[model samples]
Target chain A: MAAKYELKLGAATREAFGKALVELGKENENVVVCDADLSKSTFTHLFGKEFPERFFSCGIAEANMVSIGAGLASSGKIAFVASFSAFVLNKGFEQLRVNVAYSGIPLKVVGTHSGISIGEDGPSQMSVEDLSLACSLAGFTVISPADEPSMFALVKQAAYHPGPVFIRAGRVKVPVIYGPDQKFVIGKGIQLTEGTDITLISTGLMVAECLRAAEMLEAEGLSVRVIDLHTVKPLDRELIGKAAAETGCIVVAEEHLVDSGLGVRVAQVVAETSPCVMEFHGVNDTYAESGLPEEVLVKYKMTGADVAVTARRAYGRKK
Target chain B: MTRTSDLSELQSIARTVRRDIIEMIGTAKSGHPGGSLSAVEILVTLYFDVMKHDPANPTWALRDRFILSKGHAAPVLYSVLAETGYTPKDQLNTLRRIGSIYQGHPDRRFIPALEASTGSLGVGLSLGLGMAEAARLDKSPSRTYVVLGDGEIQEGQIWEAAMYGGFHKVDNIVAILDNNRLQLDGWVKDIMGIEPLAEKWTAFGWHVIEVDGHDIVALQAAFAEAEATKGKPSILIAHTVKGKGVSFMENNPKYHGVAPTKEEVELALKEIG
Candidate 1:
């Protein structure tokens, strides 16, 4: 599929969460949200405003917030739990693993401000390995929605889909990619461009960066195929296999640790299915220092130029 | 105007539930028997007497909710649910088997009646608080009951939940602590003591009731007192023996999760009889 430039004058990924949640509320009254005092920050407060009765405030208790989410789900309610990735997926990790994921409750977790993207808010607030933590759960579907439209589609999908889901969005507004009518499926990858030089697979905010990187690479006569892998758990194995077979080289970019993040999940599947030379671009196992979001992203080597270099290296690896 | 005096019949039913717990775990040759036996009275009371729930329709929206926080003791729950007709008694034997809906831990996907996956302790009460608070918000008149293990309460999260339950004035939530003293490691007192238990509940702004967990009437009374309390959440600190009915494993940590052998199960059934 050819890359379609999204109009991003003011739209961001986090707003899409609120926009879609409002839409979900119109369709299902059972749609509810529980926030751990980060309702506005994560945009879950939108659901609260639309469906006041269905909203629950845990008042900064992330662990308790998850417990409440599990309770609502038990009563056959569709509950979306929202908080910062640091607290929701990290502090509330045990609760997520035992209470929701293991229980297989219809709890959809939406965590914003993940990775170094939280920026000057400092290291404590940022979540560098949120994806690694959530992806480990056996039945959990880990997603890092790239643009606004995909976030909307995934939220609707999560509301109807069974089991636990982690929807990773960033506080930083990303470009709006798909229109309202764009299609989305769990375990399916959206192919943005086609190329035989190398396949660049990116997740979350990194997808937008890679898309820009792909454009730059095209100008340099290097054909790069960019895949926005929003869902990281079921991990579009078919698309990945096909990419490895055709492109023969891959670069995995994410906003988490290089150790066990989306890159590692891709490694596991590629190693078993089709072996390919792959380079991972992510936070290199070190916590971020206080800086702006853009500055930290560059320092952490997760910017578009960094991905472009990694894509070139991946292409270079292909005999 | 009188609730049926099914005391004798209920007593026998409790005995039967205890037997079911031991037999099912021993047959499966895996499960926490001590904790399961310890919670039998509480389960019997909820299923046979207390807790407004429809066994026929476990998914009833407005039904009162319950979460077994100390999920290691799932055999007791499986047995009680069977007795209540949520599932056939025959399904009890399929526990802990691969592909069996029943796993080592309670899974909501497998059992709709189960509120959350529990094995990790001190979490069920928080979940119950959510349900109870939701009920309050909806003015649904339905209550929430969460059962926490004595050892499980040692977790710091339990204290967090206890504090939140009171701060929110979750009157509809009942936190039941099965004070069985024994945990997976050893006697809870030796591992880590939870002293001044009643005072602890009182400090947390809960209407505290301490009772003999094995005595059905004491439980019946305590539950009523909880309902009557105003402006506070309730906690029924149930004093119980770890392995109550089975003679060999009573108050013994060895039986915490070790499945009884065939010979042991036979002896256990005979002893209960």
Candidate 2:
């Protein structure tokens, strides 16, 4: 089945997360959803509407919501706690770290409106360091789906995962890159395009922008490979290593802080295995102000044009 | 009131658990004895009479869940668990050891009987509420009991959880506040006075009851009352001496986190006896 929206502008990943939760709720009565007053924004309200008994609103308390999710998980129910990335990971870091992570329980921490894409809400709302916080937690598997279809797929995967998982979802709607039937495997990256000169590794909304950047590079007589590193923590080492070896150079892009997100993770993978020249494209270690999502991307150097420029720099640095 | 024989048995068990807590901490040379000593009768009543749990079947889905939100009081939980046959008696001595499952804080990963891993204070009530919610979903009568420290209530998360439990009408959650009145540094009032505590919980819509924590029968009746209350969660504000049973340690903040010396442990054990 095709997406209901225009294929060029798909729904937000949070919308897909909400829909998938409703589906899971129907399939398993044991599935429960918790939200910290962002049920509408996080899209968990859809699940709430479908299964009111299974949904819990923790008000604006993300810390309580997180530990409650742990409580549900411990008692043999799949609990998905959704909130803005910054509030959930940064504000509720201790609860997530101790109650969920240390217990090694299976809790799906859906951090919506991640990265600088959650524009107009100011830098405080943006989750630029969410990946860093999740990575610091032991036994937490982190996944940031590139689009709506993958968000639903990865969320289903997270439900079945035995340990804690953090899914980073964006606020803005983007192009429909994956099909309705696309399957997502956690801890793996997907290669969207093939090129020889430079591999563009990106995640979340940046995947679509990276694909656009690859098209732009191809038009200029350059070969640009685009790979979506959906799973940030596990860091698909084999795919990144192969891309680094084949492409010889890599440009990492994301709508997150360059120091601690997909870029730094991809750089580490390549640094350990292939030792390729890398150019980073992301929020350059500074807070981004409120603006349109696209404008925020441009200002943070995380747009399609930014990826293309960084890819060129990586290609130039190649031996 | 609980039967005289039952209360006597529970009181005896509390004394044993108190001695065990002192010995466990005194042997390890590092633990929060004051808090553990304060929470003795609360845990003993819950494990021995109030809760529906089997030591052999700790993972039974319908078993009541008890989370030590004030994780520093692991000595009390460990001692109680040992007495209840959930853990081997020898394991109590191995607490805080490198390879021992008896961690300084309750780690559910290492100890399966523990409902949640908690050390960083103020998260347990939320966890208990979640378990209670899950029990509601499953249509199970199983309840969740969370033990909190007076000092630990200073964490904003506890109040946040209190609000959620009250607003959600989570009646299956019964939180017992170990109001030992002392934290690691000093008295709770001097550090952060949480006075009118009963009014605060009542305002949050919880069925609040204050009881002398050392009274086993009173503790048991409070648990029964908590279970009897409907449409809202309950809080048993257990008024307790910081270092109960041990004369020298009573109401002393110095013993809050410091273990007793071997001689002090002997004296404390004799006092408990």
Which candidate number has the best TM-score? 2
TM-score of chain A for the candidates in order shown: 0.96, 0.96
Q: What's the DockQ for every one of the candidates?
A: 0.55, 0.83
Candidate 2 RMSD to the correct structure: 2.8
**Error in Å for residue B82 of model 1:** 2.9
- For candidate 1, the TM-score of chain A alone relative to the native chain A: 0.96
> Ten consecutive residues with minimal summed lDDT in candidate 2 chain A?
A1-10
The digit string of per-residue lDDT tens for model 1 on A212-258 reads 78887888887788898999988999888888888888899988888
lDDT of 2 by residue, A115-230 (tens): 88888998889888888888889999999898888988999888989889999999999788887666679988888877788898888888888887887788888877888888
Relative to the real complex, the DockQ score for model 2 comes to 0.83
Model 2 agreement with the true structure over B103-148: per-residue lDDT tens digits? 9888877888788888888889988988999999899989999999
Clashing residue pairs for model 1: none
Residue A243 of model 2, lDDT score: 96
lDDT of each: 0.83, 0.87
Per-candidate TM-scores read 0.90, 0.96
lDDT of 1 by residue, B119-213 (tens): 77788888887678667766798988888998898887788788888887889988888999998889888999998899998898899999998
